[model samples]
Target: MAMTVVTGSASGIGAATFSALAASGREVVGVDLRDAEILADLSTPEGRQAAVDTVLARSSGVLDGLVLCAGLGPQVSDAKRIVAVNYFGTVSLLDGLLPALRGGEAPAAVAVSSVSSTQITWADNPIAGLDESEVEAALEVGGDYRGQLAYAASKNALTVAVRQRAGDWGAAGVRLNTVAPGAVDTPLLQAGLDDPRYGEAIRSFVGPLGRRGRPEEIASLICYLLGPAAGFVHGAQFVIDGGVDAQFRPTAF
Candidate 1:
C-alpha cells in the first residue's frame, strides 16, 4: 500500500484528507498534537524532529505522499507562534522528509496556505525574507495588527518557498504544490467567527458562493493533487476560495 504522512490530521481539512486517503486504502500516518498516530506539535523544533523521525520509522524511510496541513490562524494571540507553526513548521518537516519522498514511487507533497496571502501588503511585511533572527525580530515588535500580518506573511512565504523549490524538487522526482483556501468552514473558521474583532470582516468575504467551503471539498482537491494524474502540476498554488479573492482583488492575483 502507498504510505502517506499528513500533519494536523486530527482536525478540519487534515482530518478530512486523512479519512479520504484511508478509505482509498492508503497506509496513512497522521501527525497532530492529539488523537493521531503521531502525536507531536509542529510549532517547536523538537516536536517537528520527533514527528519526522517517527514518520521515517513508520514508512521505513520511504514515503509516497506528504500533506502539510498544520497551521495557525490570524486570530492567534502570539505572532511568533503563528510564524513558528505556519511557516517554519511546514518548511522544516518538508525538508526533513525530502529523502523519504525521493525514495518513493512518484512522490508528491501539498501544503495548505491561505487566501490571506494575496491580501497582504508587500511593504513592511514581516514574513518576507524570513531567517531565524528575522522571524524573532519581527515577533518582538509584532502587536495586534502585526499578528494578522504575520499570518498572511507566513502563508505567502510558504507559497513562494514551494514554488521556488519546484525545480529542485522536480529533479529529485518529487512534486511540490500549495493549496490556498478561502473562508473554509472548519474549527479555524469557527474560531474566527467567534472572535468579535474579525468575525464580521471574515463573514463579509464569503465570495460569490455566499457560503463557507466544507473540509471535504478542500480534501478532495488535495487528494487529486497528490495522485498520479496531477504529475504535471508542480510548484503551483491552487486557490479554492469560492470567489472571495476574485471579487475583491480580481486583478491583483
Candidate 2:
C-alpha cells in the first residue's frame, strides 16, 4: 500500500488533493497549520522539522508519496514570510522526509508550483543550493515588498529544484515532479479576486475557459501524478492552465 503525505491539507487545493488521495485508498496523511497532526509554522526551520516529525509519526516511518502543495502567493505582504513558507519550508520538509521515502516502495514526490513561474526568467541566478542563512540574506535584499516577482522567482526555483531532485532520488527509486496551477477558485483566488484593484479585469481575461478552475480539477491532476499511472513521468512540471499561457501575448504577433 502506498502511504501519502499532503501538505496544506487544511483547505483549498491541498485539502481537495488530500480528499482525492484518501478516496483512492492510499494511506493519506494531511498536514496543515489547522488540522495538521504536526503543528508548526513553515516560516521557521523548527516548524519545518516539526512537520516532518509529525508525518513520520503519523505514517509510522514509511513514506511512499509526498505532495508539496502548501504555499503562499504574492498576495501576501510579507516577502520574507513568503520565501520562508513557500520556498525554504518546502525544501526543509522534503529534506527531512526524503530519507524515509528512499526506503519506501516506489516513492514519489510532487510539488505545487505556480503558472507564474512560466512568466519569469531567473536562469543564472538559481534559487536552489543556497543555505538557510543565504535565504535570509536574500530576504533582506528582497525586503517586505518583493511582490509578484519574488513569488514567481520562488516558484520557478521550486520547479527547477524538483527536476534536480529527480536525479538525486532516482537511484533510490524515488521520483520527484511539480504541478503549476493557473488561476483557481480557492480562498486564495477569491481573496485576490475580491481585491477590486487586482481582480475584475484580470479575472475576465483569464476566464476565457469560462471561469476559474475548481479545486477538484487541480486535485484530479495531483492524484494522477502521485498514482502508479504516472510511473514513467519524472522531473517534469505540468502546467494546469486553461490555455491561458498559450494565448498570452504581450502584443499582436
Candidate 3:
C-alpha cells in the first residue's frame, strides 16, 4: 500500500484529502496542530522541522505521497505568519521530505495554492527568492492588504519553487504538482466570509459557474495526481476554480 503524509489534516481540504486517501486504502499520516497523528505548528521554524522529523520517523524514511494543505487566508491578522506558513513552511517541508520521497514507490506530491496567486503583480510580491527572515521583514506591517499580499505572494513563490524543482525531483523518480482552487467552501474560506474586512466582498464575488468548490472536489484532483493515472503530468499548476480564472483572464493562462 502507498504511504502518504497530509499536512493541515485537522479540517478543510486537508481533512478531506486525508479521508479520501484513506478511503482509497493508502496508509496516510495526518499532520496538523490538532486532531492529527503528527502535531506541529507549521508557521515556525522549529515546528516545521518537527513536522518533517516526525513524518520521516513515522513513515520509516519512505513516503509515496505528500499533500501540503495547511495555510491561512487573507483574513489572518499577521502578514508575516502568512508568509511563514504558506511559503517558508511549505517549501521547507518540500525540501526536508525529499529523501523519504526518493525512497518510496512512485512518489508524488501535491500542494494547495490559490487562483488569487495570479492576481498579484511581481512588483508587490517579494516572496519568490527572498529568505524567510527577509520575507518576514518585508511583510512586517499589519493590515488586511498586508495579509492579502502575503497570502498571494507566498503562494506565488511556492508555485515557482515547485516548477523549478520539478525537473530534479522527476529525475529522482518523484512527480510534483500544485492545485489552485478558487473560493472553495472550506473552513479557511469560511474565515474570510465571516471576517468584516472580506466577508461582503467574498459573498458578492461569484465565478462564472455561480458556486464555490467543495473540499472533496479538490481532494479528488489531488488524489488523481498522486495515483498512477497522472504519471505524465509534472510541475503543472492546475487551476480548478469553476471558471473563475477563465472568467477573469481567459487568455492569461
Candidate 4:
C-alpha cells in the first residue's frame, strides 16, 4: 500500500484529506496535536522533529505522500505563532521527510497555502529561509500588530519555498506543489470570524462565488495533487478560493 503522512489531520482540510486518502486505500498516518496516529504540535520545533521521527520510523523511512495543512489563523493573538507553524513548521517537517519521499513510489507532497498569499508580493514576504529569531525580528519591525501580515507572508513564503524545491524533488522522482484557498468554512475560518478585531473585516470580504469553500472541496484538490494524475503537475500552486484571487488581482496573473 502507498504510505502517506498528513499534518493537522484533526480538522478542516487536513481531517478531510486524511479521510479521503484513507478511503482511497492509502496507508495514511495522521500527525496532529491530538487525536491522530502521531500527536505533536507543529508550532514548535521540538514537536515537529518528534512527529517526523515517528513517521520515519513507522513508515520505515519511506513515504509516498505528505500533506502539510497544520496552521494558525491570523487571530491567534500571537504573530510569531503563525510564522512558527505556517512557515517554519511546514518547512522543517518537509525537510525532515524529504529523504523518505525520495524512496517512495511516485512520491508527491502538497502544502496548504492561502489566497492571503496573494495579498503580499514575494519581495514583501521575506520569510522563505528565515530562522525563528529572524522571523520574530522581522515581524516586530514590520509591525504585524494583529499578525495579518505575518499570516500572508508565511503562506506566500511557503508557496515559494515549495517551488524552489521542486527541481530537486522532481529529479528524485518526488513531486511537490501547493494549494492556496480563500476563506474556507472550517474551524480555522470560524476562529477568524469570531475574532473581535478581524471578524468584521473577514465578514466583509466574500469570494465572487458568494459562498465560503468547503473542506471536502479543498481536500479533493489536495488528493488529486498527491495522486498519479498529477505526476506531471509539479511546482504549481492551485488556488481553490472560489475566484477570490482572480477577483482581487485579475490582471496580476
What Cα-based lDDT does every candidate model obtain? Answer: 0.88, 0.77, 0.89, 0.89
- Model 3 CA deviation exceeding 4 Å by range: 122-124, 140-144
TM-score (C-alpha) between model 1 and the true structure: 0.95
Please give, for residues 79-155, the per-residue lDDT of candidate 4 as tens digits. 88999999989999889999999988889999999888888888767665677877876777556354887898899
| Alpha-carbon RMSD, each predicted model | 1.5, 3.0, 1.4, 1.3
TM-score of each: 0.95, 0.89, 0.96, 0.96
User: Candidate 3 residues 89-169, lDDT tens each?
Assistant: 899899999999999888999988888778776666766578787876677553447777788898888888888898899
* Residues 20-97 of candidate 1: C-alpha lDDT, one tens digit per residue: 988877889899999999999888889999999999998999999999998888788877788889989999999999
Count of steric clashes across candidates, in order = 0, 0, 0, 0
Off by over 4 Å in 4: 126-128, 141-144
lDDT of 3: 0.89
lDDT of 1: 0.88
